[model samples]
Target chain A: MTIVLEKPAPARSGPGAPPPHDDTPARGARALRALGRLSRLTLTRSVVVLALFALWELAPRWELADRTFLPPFTEVAAAWWELALDGRLWENTEASLVRSGLGFGLAVLCAVPLGLLIGWYRPLADLLNPLLELFRNTAALALLPVFILLLGIGETSKVAIVLFACTWPILLNTVSAVRTVDPTLIRLARSMDLSAPRLLQKVVLPAALPTVFTGIRLAGGTAILVLVAAEMVGAKAGLGFLINSSQYNFAIPQMYAGIITISALGLLLNQLLLWAERRLTSWRPQPRG
Target chain B: MTAKINLRAVSKAFPARGGRESVLALDGLELDIGAGEFTVVVGPSGCGKSTLLDLLGGLDRPTSGEILLDGAPVTGPGLDRGIVFQQYALLPWRTAAGNVEFGLEATGTPRRERAALAREHLELVGLGGFEDRHPHELSGGMRQRVAIARSLAYDPGVLLMDEPFAALDAQTRESLQDELLRIWERTGKTIVFITHGIDEAVYLGGRVAVLTSRPGRIKDVVPVELGEARAAHADLRSSPEFALHRRQVWQLLHEEVDRAQELEREAVAR
Candidate 1:
């Protein structure tokens, strides 16, 4: 959730190593050892985060920079507590979530069918491919001013910008997923004497799914990023607008708190998408080696 | 008597690389495959064995002449001609049963009947236990079995296998050949199998058609009436009579292989 703009030096030495262990084990024991290693990694990650936060609090108190601009970690945490007690933080977070969800949902709904058509029908692809390339290359953020002019600086403009930003990745992903499916599979379907609709339903869509899921995941990230930028432009609600207002009003701790909430929301959405991907692709075998 | 497949002076030619001269894959290739017959076609690489199968299966059109199934000219791919490729082209996304069901679905068979038929075909191929498994989960031999089962599920009049066991290891290849013969015998379907392996051709075919080099023409159709070597592919491989048939087919095909190699050298020289 921390918005670390600066990169820190990479960690080298860890706390301690376990005592020299036996190399040989039964299959069951080896599996348990792997699980143990995973837990250890999780433990180490939390410790590292705690250490970094401790440094953030101590260094600011020790006069690392002007405390007015860069508040101590404790001050930011206190500001977060105040926001939570007043219930505005959750309201802002929920507003941003709603915007992102609506935009991303719209993008997916529009992209998939269009992408499937473009991918499956060669003549359509031939006609529209150039236009698609042009639009995909044109930055979605670049259309923000235009959207504002057309729709005004309200929720609609912001949602539209998010949709625009998120659409390309999903559309392109769907196209590539369909296009890159093994030709042998298509030929096999045809040899089976499948109708065009049956071929698309049975052969094309399932094969394209893994790549489409990947695109959707990327689109999720894009949606969050675009939503924040759109909210920063002009919005009365949402964490992004909170961040903007806090900075303008010289509430440094509150600004940092808003930034932290946005980061957390992004991380949480990514994790949720990852879980969905795992659930959908359950047939994919675990790595053996 | 219904001749399962009849090709009348079939010819197929591919357009050569950006030139007036076309590459003739087949020329005046006349053949008749009867019901319950196992015919193997042996040819050097690029001698158009696959092209001939394509023509028979209505996968591609012969540039001249006709390919007929039961006296009717083939218009396009149909369920009457089922093909098994060397690569075992089962859709990777689908499970073994799903792959079998694809053809049934395409042909608009009732769902319950299709499921029963798919099960029966898989059982016939000895892949009964692997129905829910995807292509990736199965071994190469198992995958080919699934493909063969899929083809058979359609109950095609003729099964055309284009080197179905070519990608298999020698042991798997021999075993699959035995399975194929058992299935062919049980179903009483006509089969036209293609292979470059001399031993395989002799082991599987009642009649072996040896083909000449590019612009391929049939050189000979050597018939093997070894009743003792009929079904057991493993035992047939070790028999002296099987060796004699292999030698005869090899002799018929050797000149074609040499001619093909010479032609290849000439093309590479250019």
Candidate 2:
């Protein structure tokens, strides 16, 4: 399909230029041009992806003849269709999501209070900062064996790993958020004769929200990363486990299908977090040029 | 009439980095604000006009003397003194009414009474219809009005303003100044306003206290006598009386302004 792009608008008139027009139809035409621009961008992106898939389906057989290692795009699609129809894919997807959701929820509960305390008291923040940094630096994947030995090879160990991976981002972001709130707002609250608790509630928390939300967004991505790894270690039903099983069986098409599904899941999670961020920060003023 | 504030030999000093370098923000400052007086403090920058306001509001304690409000020594921040900052420091998440309500709720105002008080104060500031709007949604002038409303909602005995209109555009600042005068007349609360703008001090103050630079001592306390509240049609900086007071205050501040500029350059260099 052919795609048509929108034309950029002309520069504004200088001192000697014509008087501005009052035509309503011209405004509507400009809006239509913007819509046309959006659709053309979307069309170009899809066409490029489609062309790549077409090349992948025929290239190995026609050119290199590397059929043993390279799987055709149609074969990969067939493998995806089989997984979807057999009900195993749905169960595996649900397992991964459940672990990620539970772990993220736990991390939020712990990080928020710790962050508030650290952010509020300078002395406390100095004391705990080093310990937090040390803990955050230790890799989540490296501790999987310890967790499995301690909690046994069940849901707890996997969920624990996910929580550990996600908590640091939320805590650090929350502390920064609280610390960076306008000092003027704090003084205003004091001038109002707000009690200590009331001042924190009325002034401190609200001002820190936009920054705190950034941490939550980062933690969402980290949760997904940790979940996939945790699921691959000892999990029975998950996209990660499917990838591991397919690799052992030399089911190359099935491996590609599992990887594609995992990527799509991660993309969906990122979009959801972005949507929430937009909604929560609706009160913030739009930046001017 | 209420006892009003009495400052007795108040001198505030702060230590600097190299050996007890004291900044005499206020030097043996003694002044009495009569009940319901609209007093404006004017000076060059860093002359401690703001420091004086902070003392009156009980946000900062005097280093060597006393600040007595209604015959009692002022202590920590209290609801009896309301302050409006130059920056319209509104809580970002709260609606206009919510910000007003926060002040009331903090001082243990009844829950049922807060909504009514919030609405009334907002209406006084000509923002009755904008009660539900957040600070970000309003224009700069409107947000400052909301801040004024939030400050006044608690009905403090003394209103301390530290160049509250300095951040607005000229038109908006003039309009808000007019609104402030109307509010002052309506409420008849004691006001201590601090500003570097000569015209603003002359226009708003019943009396103007001009300060010298650095070791900020009060140079002169001149009565404005442009009436307690200007007539609605009176020109702000125009006419004979306004210019007369403006000239008087300028003459007193001119030399100090030069000294302040020199000090500013020295500070920047250091």
Candidate 3:
């Protein structure tokens, strides 16, 4: 694609000369050109990924490692198919997704408004800074045992851990985002006689949104991480529990399937958040670099 | 008839950070701008030209004096005065038209009316078709044009501008200066524009007020008598009368620049 696109020789230069506006290429030629460009761009990347999968599939079969411990990619796919046919994988995935959704939703609900207030009001920020810092510094996973102790090894404790893990990124990012809005923008708003609430609604919030969405994306990853870990602790039905039990029972193929499902879920969630961010900030100029 | 804006003994001070003494930005600065007059202020950097505009715009209060709009004491930022900042402070999240409509929105103008006014102002600034473009999408000159449109859309009696063209390229700056003069004449709005450029002051205003170094005070008010030719003649900037006015303003500003440098050196030494 680069080779084809970079070749430049068609010069139509002169003062008052019209730009070359030929758009009369045949349909077949245009389609072939697009296909050639697509293959040039994507073929190498696809080859590399497929080579890794081929290695995974062939390694154990050639007795390069113990098949029982290191199952071939085919075995994992077979296990995934079996689980899907019986609906067990879907059930576990649905359970995990629901828990993640609830926890992340709660975190966003509480954190954004709190962050805005703390950022906007200096006195509140000063009062909360030390406490928030202490909590944020404490590893969220480290608090899992305490959460289990206080709330018990149930859905409550699992959701609480996810909430705890997700809240800080969203809150801290939002606080900084609100605090660092362009001072000139605020001055302009004030010059226009925009009241405090109107200024926040119209200028501060929108300006902070791109940063806030960044925080949300980070929190989305954190939520999934914490959710899986929490599910591993005394959970009966979840992707994390499936992986944990499969390993104990020597079901290596099933374990790999669970791991793949978790990673795929995370990727899907990240993409969704990215789409939301793009929609919300469409007014922003496309990034130059 | 009363002046549109009256600044009587206006002074502004900023409290020092750390253990340093408080700095006086403006000291007993007095000036009067008549209704529909175009007044340009030129001074050394940090001569409180912006501070003067802020006081007149009612965005900042004078420390020990009064600023009056017409007969009323200026209290706070109001809809009657519009300000165009040097940074072209249009909201990045808003399109050109939305930014132009900001003041109208604040004043509770109906949506349809605001849209029409915004479009009209955008057209006036030669940005008619670019109304939907965001600030980041526009060039610096275009963004400043949108800022000018935003300031004008609300129909303010007084327009206060602080070096609105300082960031643009020379060509863009000259063209924008011409556009601003045309707008000022057509709207008949009392304008107090601040700049560090002596030539810009001579080109834009009927009267140029040269300010001293901090604590800044009005050093001289030079009336420009370029007549109608100044506005109508494209070659007026290169004309001898224009040079004379530019040189006169530069001469007053040169002394203040030296004074400002000396003050800066003393502060650094202290």
Candidate 4:
């Protein structure tokens, strides 16, 4: 919660040769300037968030937003702390994790390979085009009743719903990724007399990877979204279930706690995916200020 | 001595699309390029210069006639012929050394040897210290150097370049042209270069072949006698002999350039 302004580095250059960092003082100064700007931006953002939180806490206490509908932020925090100590939050989170993880993992495994095959073979793409168009048009939530009827109101139904929801983004993105590989690179491989499999393995796969990763990240977002919706409709344990139950029982603070947790989890997921993207596609030039 | 390459009555006809006539790009083209000689093909745009290079590179088949490389019929792209495309198609994800290693890997060269050869070729193209830098990190000229290194890594006997320096600025292009000449001298590989620039044709090639418009065929072969002067002097481009050769090639291409422009207008009109 503390923001410390960075201090200038001590002189470290020696007699014969200047220290590597000291040799590039201009670059260091530029980086420091950028860092200063970034810190300022973060400070401003945090101030706005803090102001919003203060309003949330004070407005209800002052009878401004109605305490029955919107409890003070302090009360919601206390409720969240209670859930954490009692292990209720952990238990529900564990259940949700297992369901979401299985669905996401299965979607990635199935969709990537299927997409690559479809992209490589034009006839297969043609065969699936109509089906893809249909599925793309149809929303995953629209099929909830169908899934519940087919798979029954169990873990299978919820996980299946999550999988269906997550598949399209990963699948379609991968197909486009493969198709949009640079033709020049393909020609270069062919000119070297590379075998078909070898060409795909080396040139096409690496070239398509950044786009495919984008699809997976999008799918990751949808997995949580659809799983929450499914759980809200029918589930014994999950963040969504907690929120829904809290609302029914008129525990406004607990409901707010659940929503806050979901928002925090979403931020965590986005950060994790961004870190993975940076590691995988390090060759791409980073956007400069 | 047997010719390094022979093209006999070579012709290419691209199938018409969208209600246009079938385009015969090259017709009855005949040429013989000698072993260890630098040959330049020069013509106006749409004169089937690229089609002729494609035939020689075995990337495409002639609609009729034959292309023989060292007495063997040109069948398909093979390791014996290395091609340098104009755009400097270096894989952006790979380091300069890694790009050079591609052809070596395709030839199944061992990992250690591939690394060593990649470094050697990078140095040959004056990119020794830039081994770890990716294509995007390098300038356009540097990227082309990496591309040239990649093509040369597997040691192809004949180098076929398609306007490789066309994309570079004047200074970089001239320096690279000099570097290319040095490499050609040191390696003694037969080179078939394609370009539309009269100066580039005269400066690079011992024999320059000018092609006619549309159904392209050899208009004339201008023999450049400035090979000694080119090697001896840095300012061979400013020499009288260089000017004479440039004028000869320019005059041959002037009529073809107009005809090609006319053909383009007709197509646009249609």
DockQ of each: 0.49, 0.57, 0.75, 0.72
Residues A54-144, model 2: lDDT tens digits: 8888887686647656688888889999999998788888988898899998998999778987998899999999999998899878988
Ten-residue stretch with the least lDDT total in model 4 chain B: B227-236
Best by TM-score: 3
lDDT of 1 by residue, A1-289 (tens): 2122222323335568442333323434656666667677679879988897898888879998788988899999999999999998999998998889999999999998788888998899999889889989998888899999999998889888888888889989999999998886776776667788877887788888889889899999999888888889889999889999999999999999999898888889899997787677656764531
Tens-digit lDDT string for candidate 2 (B184-254): 99999999999999999999999999999987888899899776225543575686788889999999999
* Candidates arranged by lDDT, highest first: 3, 4, 1, 2
Report the alpha-carbon TM-score of model 1 versus the true structure. Answer: 0.90
**Model 3 bad stretches (over 4 Å):** A1-23, A26-30, B231-233
Candidate 4, residue B102: how far the Cα is off, in Å? 1.3
lDDT of 1 by residue, B1-270 (tens): 457778799889899998889999999988888878999999999899988887777768999999888888998888887889888888776789988987777778899998899899999999987789988899999999999998899788789899999999999998999899899889988999999999989888989999998888988899888886555555767788898898998888888889999999999999
Error of 2 at B6 (Å): 1.7
Quote each prediction's TM-score: 0.90, 0.88, 0.93, 0.92
- Between prediction 2 and prediction 4, the one with superior TM-score is 4
lDDT of 1 at A224: 87
Which candidate model has the greater TM-score, 2 or 3? 3
Docking class of 2: medium
Candidate 3: pairs in clash? none
lDDT tens readout by residue for model 3, A193-238: 8878888888888999999998899999999999998888889999
B24-95, model 4: which lDDT tens digit per residue?
Answer: 999998899998889999999988888887888777899999999999899988999888989887888899
Residue pairs clashing, model 4:
none
Query: Could you say which candidate leads in DockQ?
Result: 3
